[model samples]
Target: MAVVSLEGLSKRYGNHLAVDDVSFDVGDREVMGLLGPNGSGKTTILRTLTGYLRPTAGIVRVAGFDVVQEGRLARRRIGYVPEDAPLYPQMRVNEFLAFMGRLRGLDGQKLDVSLGLARKRLGLEDVGETIIGRLSRGYRQRVCLAQAVLHEPDLLVLDEPTNGLDPRQIIEFRTLIRSLAEHCAIVVSSHILAEIARLADRVAILLDGRLLAVRQVKASGSIRLRARTDLAPGIVSALRTAMAGVEIAEAPQAGGMVSLHVSTAEDGAVDQVIARLAAAGIGIVEMSEAGADLEETFLAVTSRKAFH
Candidate 1:
């Protein structure tokens, strides 16, 4: 079953609808990237998922529990880190984490084990006695993350997690997020397109309070094929017809030659593409495996005139 599910979820404030019938799911151990611009309702959706804001319509479920009817139970399975993490500057790192753990109902031996694990995972062992106010921005963010996972929630929600961090810090944060995903599902809401492309297994794009598209960010056994021939409409159609279930797209290249990117999880997909191209008398100048271009997909979806 999906770790998190949203069906026809909508949220409104007065006459303004912040989210409009947005629906998606985050599977177990999956990292879902939520992408959008300002006023696109990314934060609103996260709030609703975490049981902070009751939905104005439809249902939100986490681990089979309705967010509204079973708010407490659903919330207990989730750990949320908002854009600006709520922290106490006066307290030490260890002290703050312990307090948050207690708030989550951790106690005695369980609390001690949880605290130790959180500190170890977040690299906070050396900073245990350091005052939160004296820590750097990156360290503070780590502390916030540590507190969130103290109880090992089934789902973790992070909003603009790498904001205000340096390049090195951002890289470190990405690694930490990937490690966390090994044990639980994660929902990352961020404006950074590149980060989402790297971290998420799939991406859901939101625009103007509506869902634009949900796209896969990673593909196995994908290949990029470049041909010297000009790109014709028939060529693309023929390729698709030849390789069922394979995703094919024309990628922009600096040279005059046409570039096609093909992706599929099926075995021998490359050999099939080669044979099909040969059969079609299409000359292949170059062919090699390539990763998904999420930016291209994002642009195509958001730039549609109908959406505007």
Candidate 2:
């Protein structure tokens, strides 16, 4: 079941379209990545879903409640952590958490139990007495996250939650987000491609305010081959002659070598290519096959068509 859905969602400022005709769905108990470069309209979509800003057109829904039409209800069921989680400067950490709990209609023993749960979930039990202004940036980020989920909202929308965190903090944050998926749907937008790739079960890629593609994050290994230095002369010509219509996807031409990336599972095919190259007197540079790199797939899909 989809916990978060956007239908033809669009946001515009006068003549400039910040997000255009975007649509995607995030499933229940799943981590969905909203990814793009800076200003790729990723944040715009997050803001709309959070109901902080109304969309120029289309709808944002959370757990079946329309974000704009039923914002109060939708907001109650969703936790939001914006890019900069603005906290009061002087509020004591415990007091701040109480305030956050109250905002979610939690109080007394109920609030106490809920607050305790959030604190433990976020590893903030030890710092409960620290002032908001006195904590380090990493801890401050944790506080922000703590407040967002204080209500135990069914959905969590985080905009760059790992931003301003150290490497260790980032790891902790990742584990925290993963833990949330046990009971809530999560949608996180980040420019850190590898981080998202690591955590997300599905990905929605946007560009120029348009949805480029939505795809499953593949984990299967792949094969990569590098030509040995002894491949005879005219090896490039040999490859071209042997595999007509085969496209050279990538491999920088350097030191008089032409390397190429191919997706093949046959072992002898590679050996045959090398043997043929040697017979043709074409020098073969380094060659080996390895796991299918997702980064390579992402670039290849996003890049312009390769020139054969």
Best candidate according to lDDT: 1
Off by over 4 Å in 2: 219-293, 304-308
How big is the positional error of residue 59 in model 1, measured in Å on the Cα after superposition?
0.5
| Residue-level error in angstroms, candidate 2, position 211 | 0.7
Writing each residue's lDDT as its tens digit, candidate 2 over 93-136 gives 78998998997899889999989999998889999998889998
Each model's TM-score? 0.77, 0.74
- RMSD in Å for candidate 1, one decimal? 10.1
Q: Give lDDT tens digits, candidate 1, residues 1-308.
A: 99999999989999999999989999999999999898999999999999889999999999999999999999999999999989999999999999999999999999999999999998999999999999999999999999999999999999999999997688778889989999899999988887887678999999888899989885346778776547535456666888777777776667677787787665445556666776887677788756547878888989863131
The C-alpha RMSD in Å for every predicted model, in order, reads 10.1, 11.8
Quantify all predictions' global Cα lDDT against the true fold: 0.87, 0.77
The alpha-carbon lDDT assigned to residue 160 of candidate 2 equals 86
Q: Any idea how many clashes model 2 has?
A: 23
lDDT of 2: 0.77
